[model samples]
Target chain A: MNLLFAAEEAEEGGSGLVSPVIGVMLWTLIVFGITLIVLWKVAFPRIAEALDKRQRMIEESIDTAEKTKREADELLREYRERLSDARGQADDIVARARRTADAHEQESQAEARTKREEMMDQTRRDIEAETRRAIQQIRSEVADLTVLATEKVTRKSLDSSDQKRLVDEALAELDFAALANEERR
Target chain B: MSQSRKILLGAGGAYLLLVVLAFILFGSAGRQDFVPQEEFELPTWIELGPLDINKAVLYLLISGILTCVTMVYIAKRMEAKPNRIQTAVEVLYGVMRDNITRGNMNDKMAAKWFPFIGALFLFIWFNNLIGFIPLPTGHHHFTVLGLEIPTFGIYAATANVSVPLVLSLLVFFSYTFEGIRAKGVGGYLKSLIPAGVTGAMAGFIFVLELLSNIMRIVSLSVRLFANMLAGHLIILFMAGGLAILLGIAGIGVFLLPIGIALYLFEVGLVATLQAFIFATLSAIYIGGAVAESH
Candidate 1:
């Protein structure tokens, strides 16, 4: 007890101030010192740590959220780009298929027309050759019939070498190549 | 709050009824010891061993226990988010740390002295508040079979000069130690004399500064002790006067309204304000001590 707490003396006749008791001060110091130590060890440290941890957790969550948002945006952009690329490819394929079909149709038309013209030319040439051959055969048959009639009427034989010459001259008069050219013109 | 608290309140109500019955039976109590007289005079202590413990000491111990229990309970029940008591503790801690410690001192010294100053603030502040409340001790000597039974009660511990002296001495030693540690002993002594002065002027300034430095303990202790003691005395005087007048002329009832209001203001405002002043001043002292330049 300090002078004020010296109740014995102050109560005795003292109006103000009591004898300072050293023991009270010492005990108070001991008790207060224990309190201070406890505060240092427990109260202050715990509070400071809790506050710091909360702050850090908040900041980390904010950072993670931002990162996730950025990554999502990037993915969206990539998907849109791929979608456009696929559309363009589909258009190009359609155009290429149309061009191939048109070229094929034109080529087949030209080939069919050429085949018809070749068939007509072959039919005309065959007709010309048949007509010339029929003409030559008729001429030779007429020469032989006349010779037979002369022989029967006069009762005389014609010379063999002269008869062959006469048949050759008749075949010469019916030219097949000339007649076919004339018909073609 | 809790089921237990409801039960406790119920018990308290029953106890109050018992006290009322006892008061009625005893037929009014004595108010002689409740009055204040001398300026510095308070209560005395009962000597045990070499130490003299008083009513104030017991209350001081109770204040400490209250602080400990509250903090420990909060610590055990602490959550990711603060509950009521935890929030109260944090708010009080924040005020001391940011407002008082950081306000008077720079960042460097604020962190160091915050705990010490804060502890003193809470301890003194609560004790001062509890001091205003007079416990129900029945105020009667009950004799059962020729044995007198007494009750135990607590009051304002900070009003006692010894309590405040112990607190002041802690501040005194802490700052002085920090000052000496910061600047060497010789430099600290030299610092008492101002710069750019010599001879008589320097000596005069040195003596004044030294005296002022020594007076820090007295100012700190006396300021708290006086303020708390003054409030207690004033309330005691009011209570004693009311009791005396009521017993004599029954005129004391009229004073109840003003008396109750003033009492509330003193207990609530004065108690907290004094606590703040004590902590802030303590921080400022340590700040000055450890500062490279004052």
Candidate 2:
């Protein structure tokens, strides 16, 4: 009875394996069909959109950065050019100031030279005027002395007219003698 | 003719050819001797303990060769502008690339491992699909090199514990090597202990880390093997019930239709799921190996 039961159990076990296989296969097919449909329609599209959006955002950011960099470069170049222009203007101003200063220095030197020459000429004129005054006074004194000497040389009592004529003649003779002596010395 | 009709005709022709081949090869009375079963009282060639190397090796070789030829031919004939066959291949490639590889490992990493992962997926998928083709049903025998070899009509490579075990070991070693390469051995070992667990607890956590590391190999292999094996076993029982019911009763009432319906669904699901599970686990392992600590 046990042997017969074992044989029957073996047969049933063999047969039982078949139904589960079929059930699993059927379940697999249904699940696979649903998965494929859902994935194709919904999930795939959403994923693709998200990926595209990310790529676009990245590209836009890069482009914006590039544009900003270019603008900065342009501004920097302009600043440099302005700085150079300002330097050039400053150099021009310095050159003009130097030229003006040189001209002023030359004018001042010429004025000083003219003033010195005028002072020297004034001093020489004053010295010459002083010498002429002294020479004139000496000549007048010498004439009076000549008169007295003539009167003593005569050694006689005479009238006034005679004395005067004698004096004049004597003076004239002395003057002529003095002139000749000076010439000889 | 309509496009649908054209597709139907093509499919019908392929099915007829498959049926003819199955009948010619498997229908012979002489082939019964090659199927070695203690229950069936059949003879076989050399046996390795309980494992039949001749049968297993031949099946693997044949399956591998067939897959290689089909894939190579399809690859060569592929065009810039797709024909029907090319479109089919492209669709398969797209699914593997987008969903399996890219979905798990980001784009850059996917690019590195896509070829190997894709090949594995397609090979497993075709092997699983071939089991339902009605050719290699039940047991069969073939003689080669003066040896009688017993074999099944279809053998899911993933279903065999040894195959997944080998694949999982390969993945395990590969990730370990990657970790060591990316970060030195010292760093790799350091990485095993998560951050901020110090003092006496650190030692305990380290032990737990080691256990988890070992468990990765076990879980990867077992997950694939179990899923495939369970699927195959379920399919076997479904088909077998119809056969037994027909033998016992004059008419097989409700068994054939239900069995066939479930069989179809299970095959489709199992093929896709097995492929997905294998690819996902490989990606996870690789990702873990390369990931930086938080």
Off by over 4 Å in 1: A1-23, A69-185, B1-46, B106-108, B136-154, B193-199, B242-251
Q: What are the per-model C-alpha RMSD values against the true structure?
A: 10.2, 20.6
lDDT of 1 by residue, B1-294 (tens): 999999999987876665456556543544333223332333345777556564545666677777665665555565568778778877887898898888877787777788888788877777788777665322335676897763323246677677788788889889889889889997777776766778889888888988988899889888887888767655654543544523421223334445677688888799999888888888888888777654
B270 in model 1: Cα distance from truth in Å? 1.6
- Tens-place lDDT digits, model 2, residues B1-294: 999999999987876666566445543322112211112211223554443333333334445556555665665555445678767766776787787778767577776766656655655565556544544323545778997664444445455555555556667886788778878998887787888888998889888988988888778767776776566555554544323322332122224445577677768786677767776777677767767761
User: Which regions of candidate 2 are displaced past 4 Å?
Assistant: A1-185, B1-53, B106-108, B136-154, B241-252
Q: What is the DockQ score of candidate 2, to 2 decimals?
A: 0.01
lDDT of 1 by residue, A1-185 (tens): 23244345556764223334455566667667766777667777777777677679889999999999999999999999999999999999999999999999999999999989888888877887776776566566767876786577768777887666755675567565575566557
- Which candidate number would show the highest TM-score if scored against the true structure? 1
Q: Write the per-residue lDDT of candidate 2 for residues A12-90, one digit (tens) a residue.
A: 6542121122222332233333333443344334433444555687899899999999999999999999999999999
True contacts kept of each: 0.31, 0.00
lDDT of 2 at A123: 67
Q: Distance from true position, residue B239, model 2, in Å?
A: 2.0
Q: Is the docking of candidate 2 incorrect, acceptable, medium or high quality?
A: incorrect
